[model samples]
Target: MACILRGLIRLSGLDKCINLVELNLAGNQISKIEGLEATLQLRRLILTSNKISAIEGISHLSRLEGLWLQDNRLASLESLALPQLAQLPALRSLYLQNLDRLAPNAVCRTPGYKAAVLAALPNLTNLDGERSPAALNYAELAAEYDAFRANPVPPKQWVVPDVAPWLAGVSQEVPMGGGPGEVALQQRHAKLLPLRFGAAPCVSGQVVKVIDECEMLVRVLGEEIAKFGRQAEARKSSAVAS
Candidate 1:
């Protein structure tokens, strides 16, 4: 699911989607990276151009393939960054920078950042959109990871004590704005705007407003009708399965 530039303030409403394979939430005001524990099968996780300052509660995404976290506020490496990602054995692509876009976490500026990351996650084929050297023996690097995993050490707290929500998969913060409801309300008012003039088109407003209002209403209602229709249609198609 791609939800880019939606003005999302918080990362909410992905708790129960255990089968979610990919999620892209770029260009938003999200401050924290929480929720999404149930999506163990998730592959591509894109969260660039966000305000994410910390990375926690995102452990054990073993099936993740691509992770994009560039252009964020992540700082520090040892404290919470690497440990949260240590379990993603299937992750092959990790992006933290975009050439001319110049998007990178604060930690990327630190010396040996690339080397240290490659050393830790041996399976990565691409880092910051650059391919790892073919000459590098990934098999040799695998042993080091195996050793580290076999005798894991507890990670220290990042100032505050590390605490996950009572429910791991629940959304920590809901995005600001009433979303569709607010849109619908605005549209309803706009739809009846011309009515305010009592049967006269002399209200003198943008035609875009009327179109927006009607479209928003149609979209909102159409989705509801489609949702129920799908459920009803499914039963007709397969009675035994239903």
Candidate 2:
């Protein structure tokens, strides 16, 4: 038999009919379902856009080549167990569309969603229109829709914990004599050390001043040492007076 059971429901004995190839139960209102394994030879099962939200009973149809599931309230497709369908040796195509809950604008716009779906379903070559869901211009529309849906942005938290520590330490005394070059050096170190330590450390002004005074002292001492060397005899007489 090429076909059988055009609209049979709750008939447990229909399982004995193994020669059936095509079964069409489009509008039987057969919401609750079980036991269709008798039709093992079935190739095409047309249950398109029906109230069958859970495709649990259809898993045993190993010979099924095509399934039409569209225009349904299939919110959680992740729950639908179609592992066997993916492994179907003869199955070439599977159609699932018109899911009401999933926002058409959101799914098409978000790059993250598209990336996740493509990674999950490699065999699913086409969705909505393009070959890859990544090509959709959903990001823009989704941003607008999300802004409309979400609550207004809260005020800026400038006095948060991250800045609070710095605020408390800002009043501490620090060295006062560092020159521009020394201060610049300390600031540069401040930026670089933060990366190495993975956090910024509090720097004192005293250390900065000390750095500048040291630089000035080095310059003055070097000039005195050079001039003293040129007048060793005069330096000896001066030392006697000391």
Instruction: Choose the strongest candidate by lDDT.
Output: 1
Q: How many residue pairs clash in each candidate?
A: 0, 8
State each model's CA lDDT, in order.
0.70, 0.55
Candidate 2 per-residue lDDT over residues 31-103, each given as its tens digit: 5346677888878766654555565666677787765554443445453344545555555444454323232
For candidate 1, which ten residues in a row score worst on lDDT? 168-177
lDDT of 2: 0.55
- Give me the runs in candidate 2 sitting further than 4 Å from their true place: 1-13, 98-121, 124-242
CA error at residue 97 for candidate 1, angstroms:
1.2
RMSD of each: 30.7, 19.3
TM-score of each: 0.51, 0.40
